[model samples]
Target: MRRDIFTDEHEAFRDMVRQFIAREVTPYHEQWERDGVVSRDVWRAAGRAGLLGIDIDEKYGGGGNPDYRYYAVMNEEFARAGATGPMFNVHNDMIGRYLDRLCTPEQRERWLPGYCSGDLIAAIAMTEPGAGSDLQGIRTTATRTGDHYVLNGQKTFISNGQLADIVIVVARTDPAQGHKGISLLVVERDMPGFARGRNLDKIGLHAQDTSELFFTDVRVPGANLLGAEGGGFVALMQNLPRERVTIGVFALAVADKAFEDTLAYVKQRQAFGQPIGSFQHSKFLLAELATELAVARAFTDKAIAAHCDDELSVQEASMVKWWDTELCNRVTDRCVQLHGGYGYMREYPVARAWADSRVQSIFGGTTEIQKEIIGRSLGL
Candidate 1:
């Protein structure tokens, strides 16, 4: 199916992203996987290429384009290339919005330049040891004292954890206000009593750093507060739609590429002295998969268009995230089965893709959580 969501300029940008990935990401991905983190050089390179902050102000070293399609194009190319090492999406899509919308002028002047330039990497600490999807359940606390807030908490499974120069820590400011008590405080690197735990070993996305962060008796200046005090939950609710949509975009891209690869594989691999694709089972399977992908692409593109217009609802974003991620898991699993014995081998791209697809339904709010949101929206 022809995707009409993008213009010529977007296509041109896609070409540039492909070239950048080929030069920067593909070559070092394996080593990064072994090291459990990507080199900071790639982050700097992406910044130099104007990929780190697409929607940020150009005066701050960003591309200054508010168009979301640019981000979609880049994520699709990265997925197709099977390069999940750099984690630019986490930087640009997940954390950038907070800084863009909530930062005071003084805060922006201090952080945006380094963020857009890739000199300062950012991460958000929301999920704590006790909480994953429930914001109301967080236990981290920040007590105001003089000019600073004493932040004490632990965050696990933080992306870009090891390399992040500044972390937006979600801490409870008023214990009695429940979720309303949450506040976002900036915790910069090398602050006394701020420490990072080991790089966690995960089932997939080996090159992306995931870690546990610890803050104890750390006094974060009042100047580092991201938004209004006690507004972190609302801020998270606003930005999470973008993050979920980004995950959906990535999921669809992986499924599309996996289907393409598997289709080619079936045509070339012989069984019973004939190309496997010549068999009725293989042909029909490919046909079904192709149809499903086309349908998914149509809906996913629609969602992306809605998002670009800033009209994407939470329920709609939930639908896109859950449907596409589950579809991606289904497609990758079937593709692996189609590959037979070769699919289980780690060297094959399909094998790696299968492993990588497992986490999509788990993160960015689990599929179950998405369904719960959708169900509640329906007045269930």
Candidate 2:
């Protein structure tokens, strides 16, 4: 399917992103995988390339483009390149939305410059040991003091945890109000009693650093509050559709890439007397996958357009996230099976993709959680 979502400008930006990845990321990705984190220099390079803060104001060193397609293009290119190490989606799509929409003038002045410059890596600490999808169950609390909030909590499974200079910590400000009590506090790395526990070892995305963070009586200034003092949950809910859309976009991109690669592999690799793809069963499988990818792409692109227009509902975003990620997982698994023994080898891209795709259905919100959201929206 021909995608009309992008124009010449987007194509030009895509060229720049591809070149940037070829130069700054592709070469070092393997080493980064070994080191368990991407280099800070690549983040700086992304900033210089105008890739970090596309929607941020130009005065803050951002491109100042409000178009979300630029971000979609970046996400697609990164997935196509198999560059999973850099959490640009987390930076541009997730935290960027919060900072762009909720940051006060003072907060923007203090943070946006470094954020746009890639000097300040960012992460959002929402999931805790006790809470993953259930935000209301969060136990992290921020007790009010004179000029500061004494924050004490632990967050695990935080992307960019080790490298984050500014973390948006979701802590309860008034436990009595339940969901309304949650608030966002910007916890800087140098603040006293703010500490990173350990860089977690994950099954895949070995290059991306996910870790545990702890705040023990860390005094976050009242000024560090992101939006309204007790509006954190609302802010998170508002931004979640975008986050889910971002995940879906990446999933579609990766599935497309995996399908394309598998198509090439099956066409050339032979079994018996001819190419494996010549076999009726293999041909039928490819046809089904091709159809699935085309349908998924069409839906994803529509969702992206609706999202840009702010017309995407939470239910629709949940549907897209779960369907596309699950499809991506299924498609990658089949692609690996098509390759037989070679697919299981670590050197094969499909093998790595198989490992990497496993987490998509789990994060951003689990598949079960997405279904629950959709179900509730349907009044079921």
Candidate 3:
């Protein structure tokens, strides 16, 4: 399917992203997987390549391009290269929206520069040990004490946890207020009593660092609060649609890459007397996958366009996130099966893709959670 979502300029940017990955990412991805984290140098390289903050102001070292297609291009190229080590999407699409939209002028001036420069790594601490999908279950608390809020809690499954220089910690400001009491505090590294626990070992995404973070009576200045006090839930709600849309874009990219790889594999691998793709069943399966990919690409591109125009609703974003991630997982699993025994071997890219794709349906809100959101929106 011909995608009209991107202009020539976007295609040009995609070329740069592809070259950047070939040079700085693909070579060291295996080492990063073994190390359980990516190198800081790559982050600097990404910053230099102008890939860190596309939507941020050019004055702050960002590309100043607010178009979501630029991000979609980046995501597609990264997925194509199988470069999962760098959390550029998380930094650029997820956390960047929060900072770009909600950060006060003073906060922007203080953090945006390093953020754009990739000197400051950022993570949002929303999923605590007890609260994965349920925000109301969060136990982290931040009590006001004079000029500072005393933060104390633990967060697990935090992407970029160990490398994060600044963390936006979600805390309960008023225990009685439930969701209304939730607030966001910008917790800088080396703050008193702020500590990172072990780098967590996960089932996949070996190159990406997910870790446990603990805050024990860490005093964060009032100036560090992001948005209005007790408005954390509102802030999160505002940005989640963008995050969900971003996840959908990446999911489609992953599925497309897997399909492309499988198509090549089936043509080369012989079964019986000829290529496996010559078999009726294999040919039909390939046809089905290719058709599905085209359909998914069409929807995702439309969603991206709507998102760019601020016209995408929460229900639509949730729909895209769940559908595309689940589809990606299905496509990758089938691709692995098509590769036979070679698919299970870690040496094959499809094998790693299989492992990495498992979590897509689980994160950025699970398929079940997404369904719930959509159902609620239907007044069910």
Q: How far does residue 272 in candidate 1 sit from its true spot (Å)? A: 1.3
User: If scored against the real structure, what TM-score would every candidate get?
Assistant: 0.99, 0.99, 0.99
Number of the predicted model whose lDDT against the real structure is largest: 2
What TM-score should be assigned to candidate 1? 0.99
Which 10-residue span in candidate 1 carries the lowest summed lDDT?
A: 127-136
How many angstroms is residue 169 displaced in model 1 relative to the true structure, after the best TM-score fit? Answer: 1.1
- Model 3 — TM-score against the truth? 0.99
Model 2 stretches with alpha carbons more than 4 Å out: none
Global CA lDDT computed for model 2: 0.94
Per-residue CA lDDT of model 2 for 1-380, tens digit only, reads 88988899989989998999999999999999999999999999999988989999999999899899999999999998899999989999999999999999989999999999999999999999999989998999999999999999999999999999999999999999999999999999899999998889988899999999999999999999999989999999999999999999998899999999999999999888799999999999989999988998899999999988989999999999999999999999999999999999978998888898789999889999999999999899
Please provide the root mean square deviation of candidate 3 (C-alpha atoms, Å).
Answer: 0.8
Which regions of candidate 3 are displaced past 4 Å?
Answer: none
Model 1: runs farther than 4 Å from truth?
Answer: none
Q: Give the local distance difference test score of model 1.
A: 0.93
Report the lDDT of model 3 for residue 183: 95
Candidates, ranked, lDDT: 2, 1, 3
Q: Tens digit of lDDT per residue, candidate 1, span 27-107?
A: 999999999999999999999998989999989999889999999999999998999888899999999999999999999
Candidate 3's error at 99, in angstroms? Answer: 0.8
